[model samples]
Target: MKNLMKVIDALLDGLKRVLVRFREAKLGLLFIINIFKIPDFISDKRVNIINKFRLIFALTIAIIYIVSGIDFIPEIIVGIFGFIDDMFVLVWSLGIVNEEIEKYKKIIKKNKDPKIIEDVDFHIRD
Candidate 1:
């Protein structure tokens, strides 16, 4: 019973941490959701081929990690802990990929409109 409780507590803590990070990285989270729209988003002829490839690669890796069942922490060994590692990796990778996407967006926007001098702020702050 104690062990079960411990596992539950650990899972809750992990969840809290994930939520905190999600809050801090709202733009990244949003971009991850936007992954589904990649085909439409990248349809613009002005979008660089390289940027499109980067987004596709990152998303592919993320999908593979999820579907391959190759986990950093196996559920067989640790009850709830197993899933946390995968979530961490996915979120981390998405955040990175989102940064790249943001950069690409800025380039496209700037090219289309010469008056804009700075990158648009995507950060969501408390």
Candidate 2:
């Protein structure tokens, strides 16, 4: 019983941390909508060519997973549970892509160099 209580306490603490982080992010409930804007990120030439390719590839895989009608977890068999894996992939990929886009924009803002935008191969490393 004591071990169970400890486990429960740990779970609660983790939940609290997640809640706090979500609130701090200020992304709102509709933040997922922003993730769907892959084209917007791809259109921005300020982002490096490599990052753009990564975003495009990730988005293509996501689209295939969703539209192919056949996936590692078939929705016809498990209903909503089947979609969970695809959703997880999309959410994870979108988060990474969003971070890359933001980083690229910040670099452009900080440098304010027209040459930086033209130099698609160059990346400002920390």
Candidate 3:
């Protein structure tokens, strides 16, 4: 009876981990989609070679996700391999999105009006 209980507990733990990984992957995909939709990110003036490469890479990964199917390792077994693949893709996509966001933020910050800065500085000193 004790061994059966232990087995049940292990299965539950595995299920929880898989669910968490799935959720993370979904969030990562959403982030990538949002990045692709950003007008500034896709604009001719703002879209550099790196941004283009990142976009292409993300699309390719998404295509793979669709073609390979979510159950790469056979969902019945609940193997860690498939989950690991998803987690890897999620991390890679997140990294790419983060890099692009940082680049965009820097550009926007640099291009901010000098008058805006002067006004803020004057107000802060007062």
TM-score of each candidate structure, all chains considered together = 0.55, 0.55, 0.47
- TM-score, structure 1 vs. true: 0.55
Preferred candidate (lDDT higher): 2 or 3: 2
Instruction: Enumerate residue pairs that collide in model 2.
Output: none
lDDT of candidate 1 over 1-126, digit per residue (tens):
999999989987876775665565566456667565566547866677887787777677878887777887898899888887777767755765665656656766566765657677688889
TM-score of 3: 0.47
Per lDDT, the best of the predicted structures is 1
The sequence of per-residue lDDT tens digits that candidate 3 reaches over residues 18-107 is 566455545555555656545666674655877867866875785587467665465447765557656555555555555565566677
Residue-level lDDT of model 2, residues 8-122, one tens digit each, is 8996775566445445434544455555555666787666889888877777887787778777678889988998667655654555555565566576567675554563676
Question: Which runs of model 2 end up more than 4 angstroms from their true locations?
Answer: 1-46, 113-126
Global Cα RMSD, each model: 11.9, 10.8, 9.6
TM-score of 2: 0.55
Give Cα distance to truth, residue 11, candidate 3, Å: 26
Ranking of all candidate structures by their lDDT, best first: 1, 2, 3
Candidate 3 accuracy as lDDT: 0.62
Better of 2 and 3 by TM-score: 2
